[model samples]
Structures are given as structure tokens and as C-alpha cells.
Target: MNLYKEPLSRFLISYNLCSQRSAKNFVKNNEVVVNGNSIKDAAFLVDTENDTVIVGGKILPQVKHKYIMLNKPEGVVCSTVSDSHKTVYDLLKGNFNETELYKLKCVGRLDNNTSGLLLLSTNGTFVNQLTSPENEVEKTYFVKLRDSITDKKSYVLKAEKGIEIPPENKSPAFISKSAFIKWLSDESLEITITEGKFHEIRRIFSALGNYVVKLKRLKMGDFILDETLNEGEFKFL
Candidate 1:
């Protein structure tokens, strides 16, 4: 029988038991068992088909990874679980009949106040590839403004020069990569960027003397928000 191995830590993360760091710590503490023997090494490998891994007295099996597209609604946090506010996981919990399918995680986050296309998955590698800052995966959003950007020409110029991020409490201010902005209306526009930063679109508009009243993501890489999905709804990719 030809067998393959995935590190114990990686498997635990991909299995959605915990984060990679937490999984490693769990192994180092001698909590994981393989073939009835305790293994304290995170690097211990598992044969996908044959080896039985037991965690908390439950036997686990290898499962095929799944990609899920969710139409995230505003106000829901993009975490697996949260103490307050609804989580994206809450939207999925009752929808899936399969326990394995219910273990999906957000690929990248949608801020609590921002809504629209969101991707979730049971596969950790896929999540890492898309979320890595090095990849520069394109993320596009539709923004509505409280203060209209009346100066279209000035807007283009400032955008081309790159929106300057103000220094946070005396830190040196820096310029961000030029963002692609297209006007959808006098007060609404579509913006695209490869980088994900905290409060990025709002900051960009604020720097330009405009206010972002609402924001919704429309696309990321090859995935688009399914118009048919009501807020907080999802479908498999």
C-alpha cells in the first residue's frame, strides 16, 4: 500500500481542531495519540488512509478539503467562534447536515462592519495561499460615501500618487500602493487593491476628504459574490 504523510500539526490545523500554533502546543504537551501510542512531536507524520489518530477519545478520519463561498452580511464577525456578535460560523452551523462540512473556516476575513463576498474552507493550505500578503490577491469592493467625492480629477491624482496612511500616534506616515478606483455613482465607487490592511478603504477615502458610508466586497481573485445568496447565506465552491 502506497501511503502519504502530513505533519501532525498541519493535520490538526487542517482538521479545524485548532490553529497551527495551538496544534503544535497540544502535541508538545503529549496530548496527541497515534496508533495507540502518545506522540509529543508536532512533526510526527500520519498516513492518510491507514493510521488512526485519536483526540479526546474520538477517532478521526482524513477528509477531502472543501471550499465554501459565503455572502457575508454586515455585523457578523469572521471568526470560527466569538463571545459577542454573530460569527460567520453561526450562519453555517445550521445549514450543513454533515459534521465534517460544518468545520469550515474563513479563508480571509470580512471586517465586522463590512459585508459581501467571503470565502471559507476546511483546507488550511488554500487559506494560507490566498491570505498571504506576498500573493497580492486582488480584492475589490463597492463603497458608498457620506461625503461625495465631487472632485473626480483630484481623486484620480491622489489615488495614482498612492493614498498616504497617516502615522499612528507618531509612527512615520507611509504611502500605500496605488489603488484602482472607479466611480459607480457620485457617492458610490468600486475600488480594487491587492493588499488587505486594517480599515484600508475607509482610510483611503478619509485621506481624500470623503467618508465611506458603506462598503461591500464584490470580488476576490476568481470568486464573485453570488447575487442570489441572501446575506449570511453560503454555497459550496
Candidate 2:
């Protein structure tokens, strides 16, 4: 009935208590309890924020998922575990407990050198929806080139069709999918790509004989970088 309300059977599955079929059976067999009362209807709605769910004498935890928008800074790794480098998680330690912090995952990772709109979330489904290539989520980047490209239109045409990136450092040669390019100036441009291939944007420019001096992502899908967030700052959505 409300955003926080979910069917008892589905809530059981969301908590990883049981499979969908088993959840139905658990409710039907009077084995599941909600708010101290036996719940026989699998579809019976429970307010996830207020109702308590119990199964097999064990209370199921209602995990609260959080979405964070981080203006990641350079030199910070996008991993939860990194022995030699400062990870993005290091910036988030005080914000969440150890368990919840570790559960957070980067939706689409930004390399140590690349910085801009980065998404972190505890919801695996939300992460998958945004990062999945099947969804074709568009990622926009603000690029600064090492040198001005005189024949920008030609290269832009090539990129629009597709650019072939050579294999390097164990990464196989790949052809980028079609992309949209808008030149901001002689030495700068913004590119929008759907696929988040490894070093894809840099490689695309490299393949075109231009080197990228700096790269910052400005947007991903419907989410744009919050201009107010300074480097390394994050806020919950």
C-alpha cells in the first residue's frame, strides 16, 4: 500500500530467509510471524520500517539500502579492499558502521586518476540496474586533451561510427560502441557513452591519436554530479 510496505512472502525473500516458493509455504503453514502475530497470507503487507518479521525462531533483519553520490577525488581507489592505496571506503568510515559500509558497492567505478560523479549503494539491484550494459545507461565525461585537435570534426565522425582501441596491458583490443561528442573548445570536449568499458574514454581518444590530459565524468544516466559536493564529499540520496 505504501513505499515501505511489502508483501510478507516477498520480504522473506528480500531478507534472504527463503526462496520464493518456500516463503509462500512458510506463510501458508503458519511458520512465519509478523509483529508477534502469525501471518498465514503470503501477500499480507507488512510495513518494513515498523513491522518485525520472524521465521524459524530467528528474526529477519530489514536491511535499509542507502544511495550515495560521491564527488570522488583523484588518487583514491574505488575498491573496498586495497592494501597499497587509499580506497573510497576510507572516506566513508565515519558515515556508516563496519557492516553497512562494507556492504556498499560502487555502481560504476572511477579509476584513481578519473574523478566525478560516482555512485555508491547498498542495494545490489539498484547497482545492477544502473551499471548493466543491457540497460545502455549513458555516461557523460568532460575531457581535456593534451593538445588541440585541429580536425576535430573528422575524429568526432569516427567516434560516432565507432573507434577501435588496441590491446594494452593485458586488455584485449576492443571497438567502442557509437558515442556522441560535443566540442566545448579546440582542446576540450564532452563525450557521452553508454558502455563503461575499462579505460574506454581514454582509449577512444588514444585510438584517435589524441592523448587525454584530464577526464572528469559529469553525468551517468539520469543522475548528474552535484556541483556543490567538493572533492571526496558524498551525500545520501
Candidate 3:
């Protein structure tokens, strides 16, 4: 069973009860109490449900759970708050009550210009589960390249460094393993990655001496972008 788990140091820091050093000091000074008993170890584990935490005489609010899936369209920002253009929340206008939106936040971020499946939730535990590197959620993408690809280059892309380009212009920023590329015509390709990084899909092709003409995320975790959910549409998971 997945019990409420968090490092004491992180718990204190997350609740703003104290800075890391201050938290350590609090432990050392016996100023923090867990389950009505003063504890001295900063790394101590506490049962989140059963333990009572008191720091500076204030109790931390218990976090609730939430989850959402958005078909983020190009030009929409995935941020919780934004200053320019429309945000992902803008698309959900009037769909959910204030309480729901208030608790809602993006699980993972997509660049403002990228389009694809975006996951959001207030469920910190589930969010952590999905985002953890150990989980290895596979994300797929449909990419368009500015130039045509040759069979030789395709082999190179699958084997050697492929079409090498500068770091900035590539699709995926880093390639842990040689990428799997399938040619769809000469300029379009489908790729898959178990690990997602900032602008990763775009950077990888750029590094291969090709610029990404269009990019769309096709899947995340086990979910795929349903053809029925048009751009700017979303569905409950």
C-alpha cells in the first residue's frame, strides 16, 4: 500500500514552516513535534494521516487529490498562470466550477508552441507517481522535418549520431539511446521516447541537421491523443 510518505525535511520545507537550515535547526533544537512527541531527525518519516505535525504553532493544510487531461493546442500556454495569450485554463472556462479549477494544476508542462496531450491534476501523490523517473512513461510524437530524409540518413539516425546538428536547433535536447525513427514519406517521421525533456523531440531532429517543421505529441504514459478530441478539446481520464 502507498502510505502518505514524505521526508521530514521536505515536508517542513514544502509547508513553508522553515527553510532547510531552519528545519534542521528546529530538529536539533527539539522545536518540532510529530505525533505529539518531539523528534530530532530532519529526515524522519511520519505517517501523514496519523501523525500530528506542529511547527511554529501552525498546522499544514492537508492536500486533496485532482486529475485532468487537456488536448493542448498550439499557442496555448500550459502554465497555471500566464500574462500573455490564452492559458490551458482558458479553454476550460465555464466547464468546471471555481473549486475544481482552483485545485487544478498541470501535471507536466508543454511548451507554449507545442501541441499535444497534457495532463493536469491536484493529486500530488498521483502526479508524483507519473512524473517519477522510475515510472518511465512513454511519450510519442509526430514530427515534420523541413527537409527530405534519405535512406542513408535514416540508417544514420537509427544507428550512429545520425544527422548531427547543434544542440540548440535539435528536437530532443539529449538522446539517451539512439532514437527510433520511422519514415512517413520523406519529410515526416514518428518517434517515441520513454523520457521527456524540454523540447526534446524538436531538438533531436535539429541535432540531425534537420529543423522540425511541425511537432505534435501523440501520447503520454498509456494515453494517446484521440482523433475525436479536436484541438482545444479535453476528456476526463
Q: Pick the candidate with the highest TM-score.
A: 2
For model 1, how does the per-residue alpha-carbon lDDT over 118-172 read when each residue is reduced to its tens digit? 9987665567767888888888999999976568777867876798887554445
- Which runs in model 3 stand beyond 4 Å of their true positions? 1-65, 152-175
Q: Give the lowest summed-lDDT range of ten residues in model 2.
A: 1-10
Error of 2 at 41 (Å): 14
Expressed as tens digits, the lDDT of each residue in 1-237 for candidate 3 is 232455577777777767987887867875777777777888787655456787756665554444567888999997657888689988987988877886776767788888888878765555666667667766778888888876646544553343333355444334454456666878887777666666766767665577888888887767678778888988876
| Model 2 agreement with the true structure over 81-117: per-residue lDDT tens digits | 8888799999999988999899888998999899899
Worst-scoring 10-residue span by lDDT in model 3: 158-167
lDDT pick, better of 2 and 3: 2
Best by lDDT: 2
Candidate 3 Cα deviation (angstroms), residue 170:
15
Ranking by TM-score: 2, 1, 3
Alpha-carbon RMSD, each predicted model: 7.3, 4.9, 5.5
* Regions of model 1 farther than 4 Å from truth: 1-62, 97-102, 167-173
Q: Which ranges of candidate 2 are over 4 A from the true structure?
A: 1-11, 14-16, 19-63
